[model samples]
Target: MAVKEFKLPDVGEGVAEGELVSWLVAPGDRVEEDQPVAEVETDKALVEVPSSYDGTVEELFVEEGEMVPVGDVIISFRVDEEGEADETGEADAVDEAGDETAAAAESEAAADEASAEPGTADAEPEPAAADAEPETPSGRTFAPPSARRLARELGVDLAAVDGSGPGGRVTEADVRAHAAGDAGGADAGGAESDEAPAPTPTDVGSGDRKSAVRKRGEDGSGDAPEPAGRDTTLATPATRKLARDRGVDVDDVPTDETRDGEAFVTGEHVRAYADALESAAATASTGGGSAEPTPEPEPVDVGADAEPAASDAAGDAEPAPAGATEAGGDETSAPESGDETVPYRGVRRTIGKQMERSKFTAPHVTHHDTAEVDALVAAREELKPTAAERGVKLTYMPFVMKAIVAGLKEHPYLNSELREDEEEIVLKKEYNLGIAVATDAGLMVPVVDDVDEKGLFELAEEVRDLAARARDRSLKPAEMKGGTFTVTNFGAVGGEFATPIINYPETAILGLGAIEERPVVRERDGTSEVVPAPTLPLSLSIDHRVVDGAVAAEFANTVMEHLETPLLLLNE
Candidate 1:
């Protein structure tokens, strides 16, 4: 058979090597062209490598988990050929000529046996039988010896049992089945149940020792078992030391709650557990060293009028209430109320890297503006019933996106990129608006491609799909990239104003703050009366190198005007 070697190819971006995660096929398996042969992982992402040619696998040169460089031979395939190897001294003499020739001979021999029929190959030569004792190359006893003994004892038919043992030698089970007269009905189920019993708890410990003994006997080496009671929970070396110092059980802390299946424990969870323990200890000490303290009486349910009077009295107090802390403390420490540290991986890691790159690369300049969305709010209220009938829950984001698209159309410079080399600025023709979605996996900005073409309803649908995919990590790299501008909604979290960092290379990002009911002067017949209008605070950060103060201000003004007159966005 003709053999062809397949080498690893360079995937992309000048990657030198990749870890072979798994092989989809094995030796002797026939593979088709372009079929996935193996999965590989690089530093950036995981990718599947497909087979180059259609052929039967003759050899596997590299094992899974091996780091293979580009252009390195990984696998070899065999195609049906005309001639067999010459069974003469010529081939042997040529093979013994060099060390590489010896390796090739061994590989060829292995490949031959791997694709060989039964009772073939010199490497696995016949063993010695009891009668005529034909000695095997490994100097081991053959299965025929055991089969003869078993056949005589069980009174089985020698010809009835199919010989699958080495060199077509019959095994003891085969002889037993032959003698049973019902060889076809030998009860394969019963035979399986007669297998070695499951190791007991004591046997498990002994099995470990036995395994060590076998290993030592085989290779004369091993590592010792870890200390008893040491938690197996994954934590950083520094965090483990902190846990030990604080006398905390790392296993009891639930840092993985925020991370789903990720096996990582955080320092914050350790600290919180320690705090809880300290609090419990102090409470116990205060209660005359008792482990259990007296329970406080449940509050009596007051009538509605009485409850209002009590709340009014409490609201009138000058000093801050018990357990209440200053707002500044919330930023540094855990929200005195409740806080959590999500593992910095997955989408969170992506967000962190993108933000870090954006902030460092782009010279951000933020311009703040407020929009009186009184008419927009009125229009939304009017459309609410119709929107409900259409089975779509209308939100401010769609309106804001529509308005932002309108603004971008007016000032196209804002919807462009700054060149990395600081040579030239390329204004993009397409407007791909990326909405920063805050999910369980932190912030993920998924782009809405060609936003200017999509209607408000269509944009809402795309936004929903993007948000869902972003949360599930099913978004493609292209979906997250090539955004001309970004929008982060801090309004969901009740923030009034925030200067969002430009999502780098892109010229600017817009932050939508909480829409609140604020008093506004409404012009009525040349006079004005105070009225509660829905007002939104917006913060726009642009790359100072590309967009100047005037351009940013004009963009902000245009966006504000669109939001002020909601129908203008619909018309545009």
Candidate 2:
């Protein structure tokens, strides 16, 4: 039989290495070609790695919970061969290696036998010395040295974790699982003895994600018993610092992660538990012995189940949340008990980097104006019936989009991007308008191409479909790419006149604020009259490095003019 190596393949863009979350096959297991043998997690998404050849698994080169780079051999398979006639130098070397392996095995067997002999208490010093290694439990826990070091740093007990690696050996992921308190630790009696076999591909199920360990007690105020001779809380170093800074006891923090029927804590759990406690205290102080029980804090949906949007372009900075700590925010104080630190990962991380780059790279200047959208609103309402007849729900965004495109045609600089490296400004002829939709995860901008070519009905239908898909996170990466400009209707979320950072490489972004009826002065027969008008708030942010204030103001005026008289859109 010839042993063949299987290497990890490139999954997608920007993924150089991936963490091996779990192994599906083990030694001696027969695998089919294209059969999934492991689950890997990259920054983009979680994916399964399939085997390249059908054969009996000989060994797994890498353990689970470790990061493996692309093209690294991860598993080996013993393949059936018809003939083997070669007895060359390579074969002799392999034979010698095999002989050495057998000799070592014999030595180990002899030591085991010597140690087990009756009345041989001090006969096997070498075996005794080998057994004295820290984190090396007797029965199993066959983790690599890297895993042991990590366990020591995290204060995790290696013996407690259920290994998911080959031969039931503990892996890096197992140590991480132990630290997070969701390793499904062995029963107290089974921890130090008995080999815990790794679950096979058929036995293991999908969706086995690690969860945050929960705090102790229902209300989180009861005293929790500590684990014997060990730290009860299982938290990262940052979480411990957060707890100490907030003057909260780490032991009081609860988590959803539990093992051996004991709750383990994480940074998120600590923040949540402390927030609940503060809210309870505030209610008590306000009630002042009224005998009404304090109400529980309403749970915040963390968007755990939200689908991810399309990946951002390379070098695009991740976006940050509004009012997030800027570069000069206070650095000394511990985070408040009620303040939760949301890690910048996935979409949020991309947004933060993107926003920071845009804010710093482009000299942004924003101008605020209002447009009387009474005509546009009436036009949409008039067309609503026709749109509904075709099974489409139309909104004001389509009218605004058409108006913006008309305005862009009248003044083309807003539809252009400045190529600083090339020392030239390229004005895009095609109108690929990006529509920003707020999703459960974050803000996603899905582009609608050739907007200028499509009619109002087409624009309305396409816009409606794109927005729905964006919120559901079903948008493809291509649908979010090649935008000439972006439009953010913050008005839909009850905001007005935000100085939106430009979606970098693009010259400008137009923000539409809440449209409401307000008093306006109008000229009637050369006399001023005060009347209520439906006005839409507009904030235009432009790259000052390319477009001047005069150009920006005129562009804003033209957009408002089209918005007020939307029927003029047909003139184009």
Candidate 3:
């Protein structure tokens, strides 16, 4: 049999190392190609690594909780053929060496070993020391080094009699199972250990010492501990400093009693204390004491350009010219200027970088259109009750998606992306529309694959599932990639119209605004009547370098027309 070493792959942009959070398969377990072997945690996200080949796991090079650098062998597999080893190794070595030429092969191997075993370096020193003994806590023995370290970290006594590893040796798996059982209250002994400490009663009438005093003596007490000072009261460091500088006694600041070990003191407590102190001072000032001193306002200095203009009479300088005064006011009212700081991590950061690259590389243009969707609204209201009864809540988004798909069929250029470096444009035949979903963490665009092939109901179901997963942060990396075009619904947040930034690499992004009832003039033969119609405001942001302004406007108008009629979308 051939042993194939699987090195950790580069999952995202410039990720150096990833922590092995979980192992899906143990040594000797059979795995299929594309099956998840381990879950790894990078700086940005947690991702599952899949097996590249079908084989039996011969050895694990890394242990959970240990971090391994990219290009390090994490696991070895026993494969069916020996001939394929040379070819696989050469290709894998080339792929791993990309963008990481400085890392030596031996260093890579050492990283792999470290990933397979946590604290491997620290485990060797004790074996060489003559007087060193195995420091297994009284009760548990026969545990592997990894298991022993895990137990110590988790506060588990290793002397317990259960073992699940080969030859009755305790493993990390066993420790984890025990921890799970303890958490679930499945063990009565473990539950007893979790009980609260009993209270001690003080002796009343007798001259006997308290149990605490006796316990303190038994514990070998030295000098008495210092009493905590008034700094324990509720207030931020800034607030405390301000009070101290103003000669305010913090002890006089009344605060509500908090539970022992609580991490925070409420802001209400500080405000109440401040209000009480202010009231007392006001009363003292009103009761014939010296009045509160008035503070002087700081003076402003205008620049030379903003100085008073020369007057004809040379006396008043023409009252500093109206424009100079206005200019000074504008400078004072100007918003605080600073760099817009954003974390270069997670989905939002990735999106920001991609957009920056796209905008700088490709020229952009935008188009706007309005659609009167009175019939579409009527159709949706007619279907809403039936859809609800069938456990589906129909929204305007699904209708808009259908209209967009129809428009793409007629004007396929909107679904194409340009490669500036290659000097070529790619026209995608398949319709994979990415629906931009906003979550608390960031924005994620999960593609609704093969949108042209799927029916409206199927599209709606897929959109719902992708949106829910995006919100919960359960979406995989693959779900957010490979999109021909993108759609973002700003209507949900009550926006009338907005120009959404184009999702990078994709040529364009369609923005949907709120559907409002607006007055429309309906003409019948020779007369016209004012009627309320459901109207939608839409904006399309496109790369002007790839597409012209007219083409962008045409595509948007096509989408709007299809949405307004609704029947055109169905037939298409």
Candidate 4:
């Protein structure tokens, strides 16, 4: 037996450090090689860190929510090396392990992808074939729906299996390969020539439901009381939070799906249950003489108003700022009425730093305008059904994207970046546009490659797909990169004509305000009349260092022309 320390590997793209989100494995827990042990969030993504060697976890050095630098020893394992793979094989394992943030499948694939090294081109896997795969965004594994269902049926761990499908998706075939014990086929279908590891307590509902409480309690800490209906319910942490937020006991939600002999509860399940209760209450109220059952009282979180004392959670908690406490105080107290202190780290921190840099480093100028979009509106209505037939929802976004591309072509400065080190303005020929998506974590911009080549229906489908994944916190790092320009639709959330910020490095960003009916003067055949017309508001922001005020206004005009005339887009 030997003690081996597994350091936090550099999850590519030059990431120097990551904040430990949670420990998937605890001390004394047995973990297999390539099994995800912890989830770490870099500025780029939240990814699962896999164990490099198979062993009993001796101890974890880093606590939850702590920032750790690359190559720092995170966890130590007690391994019996007598029959283990050679040192060369372990090095290869280390490289494959750092591949992706266990990103969720793109709206349809599985919830696990390869660890953080982005881009499609993979370097040749080391000669050692049986060593590794990739792991997730948040804690959810990215696999297709079918692949997820299959893994549950086969009792296979998706975390241990490398994704072989597009965007590092773990397919059903890959699951089968792992189950069949053929580690030699890992690159093509993430597999290993060993029996599946027994289900650990960290994996909720993977075993007997009778062990529910014991299973969820990691180190006997942070475990809330399980409601009656929830005893046999299996759900992700996000799903549980959703249930709690909606005041629904997960146990009360009915699920027809069961994995490993336990009921599988999802966000959709909780929502449907909530809706049913609402309907029943309404029906009872209308009856006047009602006998419909009342829902059970929501479980009270006794610890909700209080955070753990600094003394109690010293290893995990960061020390209070000097001014945050009275002299010699050992804790940071809260208000009697329950004041919340959300951690200002992770994705939120990343957004702050990026915004700060852009605001301070570049001079910004915004150009706002509104185009009469009655023709654009009518054109969408005409083509909506055709798009629908192809299973796409035709929104005004695709038209706006097309218009932005046309504008970028006419004013190339809007699509160019200032290379300060080279002292040059770098112009890009490809039209990869990033569409800003509002997610639960924060705003993420998923780049749609080659916007100039895709048709309206294709754009609509792809945009919707990316947005869905973005909101669910499943977008890949690659999907978020390589944007020559960006578009933000504040209109979707009911905003109108606000100055938008440029997505720095890239020279500009186009903000779309709500399309509303407004009275405007129309001069036709020597007659003028004030008429209500649907107008789309546009706000274009540019870096003053790269694009001038006049040039920005000219680009906005080109965009408005395509939007107002509709048929003008054909000239592109």
Candidate 5:
């Protein structure tokens, strides 16, 4: 038999690494080729990594919650000459690397002894006390190094953790429970000698994702147990980061729905939790502010240029982010009497870096205009029944997408990407548009491939599906990549002619505002007549470095022309 190594494959295009979220298959488990062995959370999505070869899993090189880079060998498999999976698929869930290593070592020693003595095949080896938990002269708790490290990470005193392992040795699980503030305080157990060794940290599912945030009680008040990782909470890293940024514990975020047998927490859940905390605080301070909808703080703008705003008469309700300390000062920013410290990491940090690069690399310029869409509205109204017959909930977005595609055809530069390395502007002929779906505290832009070829209903269906999936963190990594242009409808929420950032690599992004009725003058029998018209506000932002102002204006005009004319989109 020989062993084959399997590396962490790239889950997303341009993705460098992913966090080893959890192992689906344990060591010694029979795995088929292309069998999903682990759940990895990459920058774009949480995906399952499949095994490359069929074999018995020999070892897992990385632990759960550890960030593993692409091309790094994460697992190994032992295969026979036939290159088939093991017939005996029995596995121990609690088994970790330490136990496996010790078992292998014992087997080797047994083979050596068998060669020396011909009749000792069925003999049991003598217990090795030295190899087991080494006894100390001092009365310190006999804990493994992994357990000690876990204790330090969880801020649990090893002395306070009750030992559950052989010979009263403290295990990582014991430390985890102690840190989670399990009922009944832990105390040192009387030492008892046993043959079996203690389980390692791999069994406990604790690795290098180190951070803490105090979880308040259900009603957002009173003493509560320390926050612990909820194995059931299945959220994208971005949603988790947003929770942390808002000073909310992700494990504590209440989730009702689940995806793939785990409680899936979205950005909406985190925002709701944070909002509830703020409201709870506000209600405590003011007699009955939270109950009134008017007193509830407006959801903060998450745009990059957004600034702190205290709209309430009471003022200063937003808690400042912790860990902000003066340079060289030993004192760090501390949370108030009822505050929590949250760590910023994961996809939020990833997006932040991308945005910073785009903003720094390309100078942005936004041109704002409005299109009279009275005819377009009537057309959509007429087509609504037809669209419904096809099982598509037709919306204004598809029309906007069609118009954007038409505009890109006229202004090819808008659909082009800037290649700084090659010093080339690659004009893309295929029209792939990104529809930015705004989550409660995060944003996702899932791309729709070949927008130019899709019909209105087809575009409508795909856009709807993509947007829904994006909000729920179900969007695939490929769906979020390879966009030539972007369309963000700030209108859906409530925005008018706001400047939007261009999606990096792509030259332009079009922002749509809320469609509203406005008074306008139009020619009637060669005389000007005042009339009410449904106007659609448009904001086109372009990379000033590559796309000139005149071209941007022309593109905006072309989009407006298609939107205003309505029938023009059918030809294109």
Candidate 6:
């Protein structure tokens, strides 16, 4: 047998290191080549790492929650050589030697023995009995250090979980499963402390001391007394804090989830418990019997009525500094109880670093303008039916994209990246537009490649599809890379213009505003006439080091010309 070490590879995009999130395989388990064994987080994205060779997992070098650099050994495997005795052969040999000596007892112990590793399946019956000593029928437990740590963090009772690892050892999957079940119902109803027993001795750890001592009747048949604060609650540190913030006790929060003889509590339980308390308090104050439930909003056509929703999902604005003043110029103060602190890690940290680098490195100069896009609006109305028939939900974004591509054809500088290290400007021949999507987690930009070669209908479908995927966090790392230019539509949410930070390495970013109708003066037959016209707002931010003010103005003007005369886009 040969032992081989598996190192973490550079997944792509120059990722330096990744946080090990979870392992799909356990030690002693056989894995096939190219099978995913672990999930790693890099650049705020989760990606699975596959095995390089087919072998039995010997050990995991890095524990979950730890970060490992690329090229570092993360795991080791035991490879089987030709003509070598495999685990099955070893087990068979042991069974043949034992003959019928231990055969009768084996069937009765089958359930408990099933948890043993494959290599130990045919070991002497005495050793198998020795392995079962740690796990008692009364619910004692044995788990690896990593699994124990995760159980504590998740507030899970390891004793309640059935071990699936070698030698009856509890694994991470068991802890996660226990936690998920608890979150669903362990704290379902808001049961008061008076209704349930006080907190008692739980399997979490020896943090709180129990004072009660059990005493039996003279016959020694009475049930033992339960300990104080014995309720099983599964919650993270953050969830516990949230419960405290809302003045709810985790123990009092009732849940429905009870698996493996233990109940689990979640933040949702705490919130529901608190809300119920508040509602009861309000009803008592007003002398009302009951309060009515909050009404839900009526549904509307999202495409037309939900323009702001589009913008909210398109930009990730830098979070305001703590204690900053409000819009009314009133200085904000910390909460009386205490300031709620949130760690700026993951996507937020990545965004902050990128913003700092781009702002400091690139000298930004923004040019703002408005275009009379009455023709563009009219053209979209005319093509809307045909687009729908083609199974495309066409939006103004496609028109803007086509117009931007046309404008880039005239002003190639905006469609290029500036490499400061090489002191050279690299103009991209193929247009790949990066569209900024605002997700609940953070801002993501999914690139639409070869935009210059696609029609408006295709561009619309791709933009819509990418935005949906980005919001759901399903976009791959490759889909987000290789952008020549970027477009951010703040107007979808209601902004007229914004000085958008350039996507680093890219030279310019165009910010599109909401289309609005306003009064305008027009000349006809040498006479001036006042009429309402559709106006589209535009904000172009460029890298001033590479693009001049005249060039920026020309580019914006060309974009405006395309929008004002929609038919001109066909010629491009």
Weakest ten-residue segment in model 1 by summed lDDT: 207-216
- Clash counts per candidate, in order, are 1, 23, 9, 23, 0, 18
Count of clashing pairs, candidate 1? 1
Span of ten consecutive residues with least summed lDDT in model 5: 88-97
lDDT of candidate model 1 versus the reference? 0.58
Once fitted onto the true fold, the runs of candidate 5 whose alpha carbons sit more than 4 angstroms away are 1-7, 22-37, 51-65, 71-110, 113-343, 522-531
Which residue ranges in model 2 land beyond 4 Å of their true spot? 1-339
lDDT (10s digit) by residue, model 4, range 226-345: 234446787655457556654466775666555567877655555444443333333333442334332222223433532222232312322122112222222233433587657666
Report, for every candidate in turn, its global Cα lDDT versus the true structure: 0.58, 0.62, 0.58, 0.65, 0.64, 0.64
Question: Which segments of model 1 are wrong by more than 4 Å?
Answer: 1-347, 384-391, 420-422
**Can you write out model 2's per-residue Cα lDDT over 1-572, one digit (the tens) per residue?**
44566788987666676767688865556789999999876544457788888776655655565556777566766555555332111222233223334532453432333222122224343233224322112333455544644454343555567889867777788888776774333332334213222222211111111122222222223222221222476554545655554335666554445434565454455444444444333434455342334332222223322221212343221111111122321222223445565544445556677789999999999999999889988988898999999987888887888888887887798999999899999999999999988876577788999988888888888888988877765565557778999999999879767999899889989999998998899999999999998999999999998888889899889989988988788864
Model 3 per-residue lDDT tens digits across residues 1-572? 34567889998766777767788875546789999999886554568899998876645545565556787667776566643332112223233324234432444542332211121224332222211321112212455435644553343544452787775667888888776766543233444334211211001101111111111111122211111225556444433543443223444443333324322222223333333333333333345232333111122232222232222342221121111122222112122454343334445556677778877876777788789998889888887887788777788877888788777777777889887679898888988889988887577789988887776667777899989988876777678778999999888888877877888888889998889988888897889999888889898988887778888888887888888788777774
* TM-score of every prediction relative to native: 0.49, 0.53, 0.49, 0.57, 0.58, 0.57
- Candidate 6 global CA lDDT score: 0.64
Task: Please estimate how well model 2 matches the true structure, expressed as its whole-model Cα lDDT.
Answer: 0.62
Span of ten consecutive residues with least summed lDDT in model 6: 204-213
Alpha carbon lDDT at 304, candidate 5? 29
Assess the local accuracy of residue 307 in candidate 6 as a C-alpha lDDT between 0 and 100: 17
Query: What RMSD value applies to candidate 1?
Result: 20.3
Q: What TM-score does prediction 4 earn?
A: 0.57
Best by TM-score: 5
